[model samples]
Each structure stands twice: as C-alpha cells, then as structure tokens.
Target chain A: MPTPTSSEASGPLAVETVGLTRAYDTLIAVADVNISIPKGSVFGLLGPNGAGKTTTIKMLTTLLHPSQGQARVAGFDVVRQAAQVRQYIGYVPQMLSADADLSGYENLLIFSKLYRIPAGERQQRIEETLSFMGLSEVARTLVRHYSGGMIRRLEIAQSLLHHPQVLFLDEPPWVLTRRLAMPSRNTCGPCGSAGGLRSFSPPITWRRPRSCVRLWLSCIKAGW
Target chain B: MGQTLAVAEAEVRKLRHDPVELLTRAIQPTLWLLVFGQVMSQLRGISSDGVSYRDFLAPGILAQSVMFIAIFYGISVIWERDSGVLYKYMVSPAPRWALVVGKALGSEVRSLTQASVIWILSALIGVHLRLELGAILGMLVLALLGSAIFVTLSLIIACLVKTRERFMGIGQLLTMPLFFASNAIYPISLMPAWLRVVAHINPLTYLVDGLRTLMLTGGSSAFGLGLDFAVLGLSTLLLVVIAARLYPTILT
Candidate 1:
C-alpha cells in the first residue's frame, strides 16, 4: 500500500482510516486497514475477489459498522457522525440500487429530495444530472426496462444529485462499459492532478475495466 | 418531516407502475365480505343487538384486508435489501425511523385502495354504512393508522429476519396469528378467555374498535374510541422505533 506523504497530497482528508477492521463471528474480513485519501484526489483500492473491498466500502459508507478501529469520511466519523457523513458523501453501490419500479427521473428526484436539495433547484439538478450521465433521453423510462448500463448510469445520477464533497463507489466500471465510468470524473474531477473530489474505487481484478485510471493503487490481498 | 415524506413519495411512486396490485388486493376482502360475512351473519349468537352480522362484519373485513396488505410489507423490504435500493436509503441523511415510517405511510396509501374497495362493496350490498363525509374521513384515518401499525410491524420482522425466504415464512406465520388473535374477524366478546386477553393487547383490536364505531351507524367501540386511537397510535410509534433500531441489522 502506498500511503502518500504529507507533501505528496496536501489537503483536508476526504477519507481517513486507522486500524480499521471488520469481523464476522469467527473470521476477520478486513483487518487493521489504514488509508488516508486527501480531498480532490482520485484513488482506488485494488484487490482480488474475496479481498474485503465491499465490506470496507460498506463500513466507510456507514452501511455496516466496523468491529474494530475507526474511520471518517468528509471530516466526520463514519460511526459517530454517520448522518453528517451521509450528508457530505455520495455512494453508489455495486448492486442495482435504482428502484426498478420508478422511472429514471423519479429515481433521481427521490434522491434529490432525500438529499434535501431545495425544492426549486430539484428539477434543474435532476435534469442536469440525467444529461451529465447521458441518461436524459431515457429519463422517463422505468428502470425495469433499462439495460444494465443504463441502470448503472441512473444509479450514478442518483448519487451525484447532491453534489457531495466525496463520492464512494463500490466497484465502478465493474462490468460496465468504458463510457459508463467517466461521469465519475464530472462528479469526482474537482481537482486536477493535485486535488478534487475524492473517490474510492476498489476494482476487482476480474471485473476491472481497461480504461481505469491508475493514479494510485493500494492493493489488498485475499482475506484482506 | 420533509425527508420522511420524500421516502414515502418514492415508495408510493412504485404503485403507479402496477396499479393492478391494488385491485388484486381487494379480492380477498371481497370474499370475506360477500362469502364469509353472508355465511357468518346467519349464525344466531355472533352479532350484538340492532346490528346485522353483515354490518357488524363490514368494518372487520376492511380492517382485515388492510392488515393483509401491510402485513407482508417485509417482502418488499427484503427485495430492497437485495436490489441495493436499501443501501442508498440507509446511507442517506434521512433518519432511520423516518425511513421506516415513510415506508409504512407509502404502503398504507396502497392499502387504502383495498379499504375503499371494501367500502364500495359494503354500500352496494346495502350494509347501511355511515356514509357521511365525516365518518368516511374518520375511516381514512383509522385505516391508515391500522395499516401503519402492520407496516411498521412488518418492517421490524424484515429487520430481524433479513432474507427473503425466511421473511416470507415468518410473514405467513405472523399474518394468521395477528388476524385471528385480533377483533378483525370476531368481536372480543365472542373470543375465548385466553384470546380475549390477546385481543385486548393486540393493536388490531383498537383499529377494529375505531373502524367499527366509525363505519356502522349503530356500532360503538367495545373499547372507547379514545383508548383505541391511543393504543394504535402509541403502538405505531413504538414499532417505528424498534424497526429503526433493527434496520441496520439488515445489512448483515
């Protein structure tokens, strides 16, 4: 793991983990992991199939509580200030998180409301997000009828509807086409080479897309 | 309140894609009212004075139908968990109880379709319902309140059981006991000694009590309307809290 020196990436930390660990009853899925992602930096956690990438994201996103150690996102403790963390971070899970029963626009609108975007700005924000993700044409289509890639884009649109400070993606471009992955740049590309919105992408070896940016790779081995 | 309404708005929007579900839900209530009520109303000792068995059973079937609609709300929660829609909600700024109640409120709106179906059917069959605007409005409150309790209870079950298969089995396990043990089918007076105790403690009893008083002209609450509302209202609040706490367990 390449833990950057202070001079390498200097800014308020978008994400920081220290001795982070998660354990099932008898097995530790993620053990004593530590990484500090400075705001405006794009990074990925590379690992194998059973390498605990999903569990780590789940903990950082406040979806699951870590068994040991502590981590924070957007300057808030993932556990103690989880609500605040949620306020500042946008997360798109690997699974099909978009509601199949709803149209793409409705999904984004619901998320916009949940994020408490002002009512006046919601329509334009959702429209802009749909267009930004290349989903404007099919905005009225039910997610149930969408192709895998379209569904993935809608999910991405839902997360970015809030303009969060940091975006945490479960496994972007995992099983997705090339064009499907770049919008994260629009949302995450706040910083040029030095800094911007921080994104945590842990691409599994089998599913990593060819176009993945290789700015920095912190590889976690199996059972990590 | 804004966040809670938003979560509910999302869930409610799904019904637009499948409005037929509301019509289908009305089927069971139809059977209970037309078939079961007709047969049971003939029995000598079932209904109290001045109330025919059909009129007596109208509100009960309405309560039962709404209960049936909401009691399995856990299944959808399990689906949300699997599809990762739940993860989005979980990680949102919305409060957990708000999520639970918002979801309950959404499904409760769908249950009203069944409630209205039963109401229309009750009027058609000449059950002599209290059709005044106020009574019907009051029924709306009771129906939503009744279904909200079941929805929150279902969410609690979803949080505990987690998986779809187990949730289905437990959902089935709960609906019958919750239905039969409550005053939805028969009055508390007709229940045996042990079940009478269960009926008193059952939140559905209060719902039925309130629904019965409001739905029928001559009907009155076995337990006063105040007690009925107090019990169901408090129970919904309690279940919301419990479901919210157990909600994170779904991720495991």
Candidate 2:
C-alpha cells in the first residue's frame, strides 16, 4: 500500500490502473490492463461486447473488486479505499439504475440522502440537477413514464447530485451523447466539458459494425 | 444512520407510488381473519387450551400476514438487480450493512402497516385484544423484528439465487412450511412429536408465540413472552449480520 503524496493528490491523473486483472475462476475478464485517465479529459474505451469494457468500469467504480493488481480512482485505491473512491466518483451503468417506480425527482432525492447531502442543500441541489439534465419539466413524473433518453439523463443527474470528481459511463453513444451534451449545454461545467468524463463503449470493428454506430454518432454529433 | 434512512426512504417512495399494493396485500389477511378465524373459532377441538379459537387465530393471522408480506421481499432484490437499482446502492459510499438494514427497515414499515390492518380486522371480527398502548407497541416491535428476520432471510435467498424464478420458487417453498410448521396455525402441543421439534426451532413459532402472548392475554403465555422475544431479537440480529455479509455476493 503506497501513501499518496500531496503532489499525487493534485496530480493530473483522475484514474490510474496498473496490472489490473479480474478473473472469474478460469476466465480472465480483464487481464493485466493498464490505463491512466488525466483529470478534465474525456476518454473513451472502445471494445467489442464481452471485451472487458464493462469489467474495467466495474473495477474502477468499486462495484466489482479486481482479482489482482492495483487501481485508483480520484486519488484513492478502489480496493482498499472503496468508500473514499465512491465518495469522489460517480457511475452510470449500462442499464438504467434509477427506480422506475420513483419520480425522477424522488430518485435524485433518494440518492442525495444516500450520499448524505446536507438537508438544507438537498432540495436546491436536486432542483439544480434536474434542471441541469433538462428534466425539470418532468421531475415529478414517474420514471417509468420517462423516455429512454430521459431515463438515462435522470440516472446521470442522480450520479452528479453529490458532485463527484470522476464519472464513469458504461454504454454506447446515445447515453454518452446525452452524458456529454446535456450537462455541457445546460450546466456549463458539471459532467459535460468539465473534468473526469470517462465513457465506455463497444469497439469499432468490421466484424461487428453495428455496435459502434452510436459511437460514431456521439463523436460526430456531440463533437467528442 | 442517514444512509439507512435514505435506503428506507427510497423504498417508501416506491411503496408510495404503489400504495394500491398494500391494500391488495391486506386482502389475504382479511380473508384469514374474517373467514378463516370465524370458521375455525367454532371448532371445539382446536380450542382445547380454553382460549377461543378466534383469539388463538388472531395472533397467528397477524404473524402469518407479516410472514406473507416479508417472505417475498427477496424478489424485489432480483428486480432491483435487474433494473440496476441494486448496483447503484452497491457503488455508493453507504456501507453494505447500511443498505441491508435500510431494506429491512423498509420491510418493517410495510409490516407495521399490515399489523395495523390485522389489529383492526381482528377487532371488527370480534376477536378480543388487549388494546392497550403497551400491548400495541409491543406487538408493533415484535412485528418489526419478525419482519426484519424474514426480510433478511428473503435477502439471503435473493443473494444466493440471483434470479426471480428461483427466488420465487424457494420463497414459496419456505413460506408455507414455515407457516404451517410453526405455531401460526396450530399450537405446538397439538403437533406430532417431530413437528413439535421443528416448531420449537422455527423462528416463526417464536414470533407467533410472542404475538399471542402480547395480544390475546395481558401477560405471558405457555411459550413465555420473554423467551419468545429473546429468540426473535437474537435471531433478527444474527440474520441481519448474515444477510449483510451475503449481500455483496449477489453482485458477483
């Protein structure tokens, strides 16, 4: 266990993983991969389905523990300092994480409580997040009534409620486009053009050309 | 503590959206109390302990209602997992136990509502109750403890099975046996020797026994309210620890 120095604390690296490997019995999902994401940089991971992109996201987000090796997110080791890592990082998984039964506002409010946001600040912050995600119009509407893109935006909004330093987006371009476009357009600096926006998507390959369709679109439309 | 409440509040918000489900849940216990208790109360053989059959059945029905409400809670975990809500909680800064406890607290709230319904139903059906504040509060506490125990058990099953089908199958399999095998439908003394052994070991037996003692008569019954509550409290505490420990395995 290495102690992080003051300089490393303020370093440009938002995420760094060295020799990070996750094996499920005989199969190694992510094998000895190393990558460093600089702060304030928007980096995309391109891999085919089952190519360990989600696995990498899981490890970095502290949702899945790495089998062997070292990984740090937001200056904290994901394995040893998972709570601290969670505090500084946000994750929007491939699937919709917000409760469908809850209104978009309720979902964000619940997350605010889980993150222990101050009572005085919670309502204002939730309003700000909803507005930032362009969801204020339907904040009171149940998430089940939300559109696919709206649900994705609500999830991203909830993750940003606590204002984490690093954000991990696991999925293809539509979510990525929303992730990149909405915040930059509305809030001006949160998850959009701001620091620590990492997106994961399936790789671009001739064998499976359809998977990267959104990838190309996001890069073109969102200007990523 | 705030995290626990947050998790519980989330569940409450969901429940609030589906308030009709709670009413639908009341139908089962309503049938048991109104129909089953009425029919069974007339039978002399089942009331050999000198207590009216309705009185005996009232507490049992309360316990059964809580069991029915809680024993299926695991299916929600699978739903949450599939819907990605569980993953969100897992990645949060909240401790795993806080999440589990929050879930249990959520179930506790449901069970509390169920208890109130049962109490009113029992009174309407002419089943005598202590009706005292202490008795009501005691029963509420026991209902919460009982609910926590079964909800934790459900969570354990959810963690182990990881799918709605298996969880529902196992949950259905466990609930009936747990209900009939316990003193919920019958006194342990009326059971055969083998069943008496099982009933003594079953946590529901303790819950039912506690409810019976607290609701039917003023003081303790043959099963001893002290022992009943002790077993339930200890078992709930133990299961909470086990459930929290098993909770993370569901993600893998």
Report lDDT per candidate: 0.79, 0.79
Runs of candidate 2 with Cα error greater than 4 angstroms are A1-12, A175-179, A182-224, B218-220
Provide the lowest-lDDT 10-residue window in model 1 chain A: A204-213
lDDT of 2 by residue, A1-224 (tens): 12233354644577889999999999999999898876655566655567888888888888888999999877789898999888776777778788999999999888888888889989998998788677999999999998888998888788777766676777644554545443222222222332333432322111112211111111111233
Give the docking tier of candidate 2.
Answer: medium
Per-residue lDDT of B26 in model 1? 83
- Itemize residue pairs with steric clashes in candidate 1: A40-A196, A190-A196, A191-A195, A191-A196
B35-122 per-residue lDDT for model 2 (tens digits):
8777877777874255788778888889999988899998898899998888889988999999999999998888889889989888
Query: Per-residue CA lDDT of candidate 1, range B1-252, in tens?
Result: 888998889878888777888887888889999999888888887755368888888888899888888999878988998999999999999999888888988998888888988999999998888878998998899899899999988888888888889988998888788789987767777778999898778787788889989999998888888888888888888888889999888878
Write the residue-wise lDDT of candidate 1 on A91-183 in tens digits. 888788999999999999888888888888889988888886788999998999999888987887787677666677776653343454354
Question: Which CAPRI tier for candidate 1?
Answer: medium
Judged by TM-score, which candidate is best? 2
Candidate 1 ranges beyond 4 A from true positions: A1-11, A174-177, A180-224
